[model samples]
Target chain A: MVERTVRIGSTHGLHARPAKLFTQAAAASGAAVTIQKAGGAPVNAASILAVIAQGIDHGDDVTIVVDGGDESAVLDQLVELLSTDHDE
Target chain B: MMEIKGTGIGQGVAVGPVVRMAEALPEPVDRPSHLDPEREGERARASLSVVAAELANRGAKAGGAAKDVLEAQAMMAEDPSLIDEVTKLLATGKTAERAVYESFAAYRDLLAGMGGYMGERAADLDDISQRVIAHLLKLPAPGVPNPGHPFVLVARDLAPADTATLDLDQVLGLVTVDGGPTSHTAILAREKSIVAIVGATDAASLADGDTVVVACR
Candidate 1:
């Protein structure tokens, strides 16, 4: 699995809209992906429900893991998604 | 009507009828499930999925910026961690309604305890919990009131879902008894250029049809 820790860029954090966008992207990637807040348990990144339950906020460090299926490319796309300010 | 002080949103002012959003459903009573744990679990799962799907549908209909907010809410309805929590509660013989309520409350308390931006999320959790419980009980989801006329909306606060579907043409202004400048109610008001005052604790006593001035300076 490939993993990267990135800071959340959405000013309002990873609440509803950003969480939905991130989860939809993860699910579409067709990769086994998981996300974890700092020192928190890892959750299915593609499950919007799991992502929002984490209550991740702006500037929070989250680790994204992609286990297979073109890991580098998928991770890069997810990283870009996480680091963009979707709330703007 | 008596004047109430709060942080105003935008620079506009409006006056009209007062229509209050329904108060949140009362907390679910803590009681053992009359049905077996498995049945209770099934019931809980069904309601969760139903609420989630409804939210997703609303998102699709809303489109644009509101679509994202509604979609996020739909996710909260079916979140994996939340399901785990509800299942655990069900295993303890709790009814599906109580299980969903308590499970969401656990997360709501967690966010509220965090304070600042996270604290504001407690309202979101409350909104979700209400949706799930309302589904389980076969009740209409509690939200914005349609009094069949343009009115000044009064509520404790406006959830994202409520604000997304609000009839801007019918709403002359908004007044909340509890909410800050950053609350969802405030954001929607500013975004739509509607007059609003939030965090006016005194507004709690305002009733339906009350006439009040929303002085935005």
Candidate 2:
């Protein structure tokens, strides 16, 4: 399993549209990916409910876990995705 | 005999007794010491499956995107992973209620945070804020007097999501629990030419099925 930490950059943190977008991106990876807050149990990264349920806020640190052969590529893209906020 | 006011997010007027719509929290299940964790998990899975099936049937009757979302939720509520998690917690001597409480804490916090975040970006932020707050309001303890088919909805607040879900053709006016200038509900109501009132603290106390009028500035 490979893990990475990223900060939320969305103006609204990770709610509604942004959450939907992020989950879609994660789902596209085709990897068994899970996200969690520090000390939180991993949840399905592709489920909007699970993602929003993480209670991530702007500037909160989140750990992403990917376990599979393509873990490295998935981690790279997700980290890149989390780095920038969506446009208004 | 009196009128209460709130901002209206959707256009049009509806008159009826206020009927609060809120989901009930699930009750805790008792487990016997003789039951193995795996067996207990199967039981939880079965119960969740029944809930999901019931919700799916309800969604089909509802017929809309909202209905689709409910269907999706039913699936989540039945997820094997969710079942396993709940079972694991129960196996550790945690009561079902306690487990659900702990698990939902994160979900609740997330929703609250999301509500706050959405509020800041909202073009009509105030109305959305009001609606978000309404999520916390308790339905009248003794079945919030059914506003026997409310002709107009008087609320402390109404959010965009709530407005989106409401059928505007049925509402006569909207009164809010909280809101001020720049409330999205007011703006939207104005666009729809729906009568509305805002910033009324006692709006929720109006008698069920009372006929009232509103003047929107």
Candidate 3:
């Protein structure tokens, strides 16, 4: 498994629209991925409900774990997604 | 006629009879399932998919901002964490209705407990739960009313699902008893330029078929 940490970049944090965009990308990635907020339990990154429930905000650091597929490539792509401000 | 007050959205005046959103469904009973867990799980998944598809369909038709909101709601219907909860409940011999109800309720309370923005999201979860339960029971999906004519819409609060597909031609104004200025109801009203009064606690007394003028400056 490969893990990467990135700070959330959306101005309003990972609320509805941004969360939806991120989860859609994650679910489409075809990798076994989970996201964890700093000091919080990990949850399926593709599950919009779990991700929203985490209430991850802008500047909050989150770790993404990828256990399958092209680990490095998928990790890098997800990290890119998480780092961009979707609200913009 | 009595005048009630709330934070208004947009500047408009409308007079019409009231058409209240359907009341929330009763909590599903916790009776043991008569079927095997596998069958119950199949039934639950089917209803979840149906509701998800319906929400997405509404999103597609509404377009614009409502598209994203409703699409996210569609994702919520099949969320893996919630499905896991339902699986556990079914393993305990709970009926699919009760299992789905309790599973979503658990998550709903969790989100609501977080308060603030998260608290507001609890309603979205409740809306999903109600849709799935209604599907399981083969009952009409609970949401905005289609009274077959022009009227004012009054409700405790408008869920995004309800607000997204509102018939602009039929709904003259909106009155919500429990939402704030930042609620989805208000936001959509502003976007759509609908006359609205939110947090009008007194509006609850306004029964169906009651005619009233909603004037917002």
Output the number of the lDDT-best candidate: 3
Query: Once model 3 is optimally superposed onto the true structure by TM-score, how far is the C-alpha of residue B84 displaced, in angstroms?
Result: 0.9
Stretches off by above 4 angstroms in model 2 are A1-9, A27-30, A34-65, B5-85, B92-102, B109-115, B118-150, B154-162, B176-199
C-alpha root-mean-square deviation, candidate 3 = 1.5
Give the per-residue lDDT digits (tens) of candidate 1, residues B69-181.
Answer: 77777877887778889999989999999999998888888778777656766777889889989988998888888888899999988888887777888888889988888
Candidate scoring better on DockQ of 1 and 3: 3
RMSD of each: 3.2, 7.9, 1.5
Q: Who is ahead in TM-score, 1 or 2?
A: 1
lDDT of 3 at B197: 96
Q: Candidate 3: which stretches are off by over 4 Å?
A: none
Residue B150, model 1, lDDT: 90
List the DockQ of the predictions in order. 0.49, 0.20, 0.77
The deviation in Å at residue B187 for candidate 1 is: 1.1
**TM-score between candidate 2 and the true structure:** 0.55
Looking at model 2, give its docking quality level.
incorrect
Using lDDT, rank the candidates from best to worst.
3, 1, 2
lDDT of 3 by residue, B18-132 (tens): 9888888999988889999999999999999999999999999989999998999899898888899999999999999999999888888988998887887788889999999
Model 1: how far is B203 from its true place, Å? 1.9
